[model samples]
Target: MYPERFSNLPEYAFPRLRALLDHHDPGGEVVDMTIGEPKHPFPDWVPTVIADHSEEFGRYPPNDGTPALRGAIRDWVARRFGTTLEADSQIAAVNGTREALYNVGMALFPERKAGQVPLVLIPNPFYQVYMLAALSVAAEPMFVPATRATGYLPDYASLPPEVLNRVTAAYVCSPSNPQGAVASAAYWEELFTLAERHDFRILSDECYSEIYRDTPPPGALEIAARMGADPERVVLFESLSKRSNVPGLRSGFVAAGPRSMARIRQLRAYTGAPIPLPLQRVSERLWAEEDHVIANRALYAEKFAMADDLLGAVPGYASPEGGFFLWLPVPDGESAALRLWQEAGVRVLPGAYLSQTVAGENPGKEYIRVAMVAPKDKTARGLTSLRDCLYR
Candidate 1:
């Protein structure tokens, strides 16, 4: 018998999209704008670095992370966020932040909070893993809406006092996945303050932090440091996938307080898949270099501009402040997506698929998420077709 924990889970996003669209023939040359895989070139030197360390792969890699790799991550955090973190005590590496994002809940959430079943807070239309993580721990998974009215960030403070008291942790995505709304310094402050009052940890997913419009989004770690908040109060997950265009490498780091780090590392020793040493070596070098990341950001900036030029006049079209997805409004997400596929040959994800329906209302019911990971010209073509097909 299957475990009941995941029985209520909806079909995953891509498979659901495939079932919806694959049966129909494309009216034009098909353009896939559904997934967020980066199409831009990663640095050419990456293979050479991996080759140089290839022999090391024969040895079982450290379950946490190599000292050099962790040091590089520590230095990058210092440079990017201006917060000091000890590589040995405060950081643990994983095979992408997705793994850490899921496993952290298993490692940290207590059986009870305030003598009640713990609650794990999540933003609606969020990365699906957050809710699953909450469920793995048997915590009551609470969905807080991050709609236009709320600046596309969840407002945990709005929850009742009893609910807040039972919260063990919250998952927040800055420069959020589908909408691309970034959390400001003030937003982080407010959320951290709420966490302080509620006595819950904050999981800050900042994978898209490197891909923004004009300014680098302020991070929770830096904000917490500035406020002199407890270091254990905030845990950050960052990746080389979005930043360095190396999703296949599956290398990222998680930083937390000493006690939490120990727990995370201990958990890793038992069941975690550590990144291969050769790949870890490559990630270390990538984190040290800034030129490649700058160039990558510029490419996305051009695409963002193209999306605006094509869809700007469309009603309810809002440009994403960061990340590469456009959460475009439509009359109905599924209907619009089907029409886009059959008529314009553009594949997009229905927003409702990423969100949970609560009280008979799905926050993403009226939207489709379009990825801008294609090349500039291809992305432009898809955007224009989408605009013509859906809006006009």
Candidate 2:
């Protein structure tokens, strides 16, 4: 009975990779580049802070978040975006943005919209949680193509009136995963305009906000505030995983208007695994500090520059403006991945694993997503092997 809900979902990305290539022995020393897990060092001070607050682990953490943690998030938001927010009413510290992303659909999605089955707009080649979240709420998920043709971001404004009218929410990933497309300020404004016209909400995922170059990616909340849009229009999710190199820390946050936050916190009261208090204490420190995040971004920047130096001359190679991934064009993602693994022992993810097949074609079928998350030397070796084996 339980299987029916998620029965339509495809096999997840990693397992699919295993099925495709695990049976074969490595052609050379394995150069794993498939998973997006960061290999950089986290703040050395993190453990000290956690140890100092270890006693708090005995107590149950706040359902949403501790006052200090939420306040730190608010301060970070203000400092980073120049937009002030109410920590008490508008923010909730989540285990990670992944959990918050999934639960937002549960907490905020309406049973019906415009007297019809509500639709959730998801970018194709998306973070997988967005689709699962939509399905959890029984909303029909519309996979909008975010391919090379669309500038690697979905053009939601182009959707027909029928589709727009039924949209309960839309998930947007700035510095989007796998593809590394960063949404611009004008893009956010256009999205806000569309939402205002259609009365749908925007779920903006900006976990990679800090992993950029000269210009920081414009956030939905910042743009919405500039336009003075409804406070309830955008739900923002962010994380310290990429920003602070603490994926295992499983710490992130969600911010929304009072009404939406209330719903989120209420649902969280029942289903949330509130972060352990010690971890919350550590998270408070992580969100407030900037030096470590800056250092972390510099490390990624170095790796990105390396990717450009190596792959810049290759056709269809675009140095990501933000985020640490290369969405390289290939004859077929699955086939290229297989060849790379067998011929050079370089592991990479097929872009098709991250996207849905809609209509007749999978938009990612012609591309492969390479994560530049390994150490400098290892990443250099992997990229060289990949270029030699595939591009050559």
Candidate 3:
């Protein structure tokens, strides 16, 4: 029997998009700008390193990750974020950040809270996993709007007392998917304070932490350390998919306060799928090196500049602070997506697909998410076609 918790769940995004636009034929050559898959070149040495470690694949991989991989992650965290963590005690590797993100809900959410159903606070127009994770635990999933009026960041501090009382966890994405909004230091401070006050865990999704135009985005663990907040209140999930252009590598890690790490590790010990041994070796190398990441960031910066040059002058065009998406404003995201596909052959996701309807309104209805992960020339052409076919 299907779980009652998922009964009201909205249709998954891609199928909904297919239903919305499948009848129409493209007016021009198709250009897909919907998904946030990275298109940059991966490091040349990665394959060789993975192949070198191929002999280890016959053995079951360690749930806590190999010491070498863990040390590399620890060193990378220290170098990148200036936060020190013991490789053995405070971090655990997962197949990818998505698995870590989803499983955290299973590991932490309580059966009941304050004599009521527990709440899992998630940003509207958030990663779909956040909501599903909450539902999987039978927690009430609260969608907080992250609209332009709120600087594209949810104002969790303003939530009603009842909601706050029941909240057991909150999922926040920095360099947020679809919006590309990076959380500032002040934002982190506020969230940290709120988590402390409300007694809820903060799961920070920072997979897009490396791709930025101007400055590096501040990480949740870094900010938590700087604030001297309760260490266990925050957990961070990071990935090599976006950072190293190795999505198929399926390498990511979760770092948390020791107590949280213990719980997550305990749960993962039985159910978690560890990244394969060879890929872990590749991830170790990828995290320790910065040259390839810097080059990839520069490529994205160029794309951001190209997008600005093409679409910046348009009304309601707000450039993203970090990451590789452009959340372009339109009259209606579904209609604009269909129009772009039918007229310009540019495939983009309707903002509505990424958001839930609340109070009879879908916050993402008037926008569309454009991924800038294609090659420079192709991305430029796609953006120009989108601009002329939709904006003009």
Worst 10-residue lDDT window, candidate 2: 1-10
Q: Model 2 compared with the native: what TM-score? A: 0.98
Shift of residue 186 alpha carbon in model 1, Å: 0.7
Candidate 1 deviates by what RMSD? 0.8
Writing each residue's lDDT as its tens digit, candidate 2 over 228-267 gives 9999999999998998898988999999999999999999
TM-scores, each model vs. reference: 0.99, 0.98, 0.98
Q: CA lDDT, every prediction?
A: 0.93, 0.92, 0.91
Candidate 2 global CA lDDT score:
0.92
Clashing residue pairs, candidate 2?
Answer: none
For candidate 3, list the clashing residue pairs, or say none: none
Question: On residues 1-392, what C-alpha lDDT tens digit does candidate 1 reach at each position?
Answer: 86697798999988999999999998688999998899999999999999999999899988888899899999999999999999999998899899999999989999988889999999998999999898888888999999999988899889999899999999999989989999999999999999999899999999999999999999999999999999999999999999999888999999999999989988988989988999989988998999999999999999998888888898888999999999999999999999999999999999999999999999999999999998998998898899889998
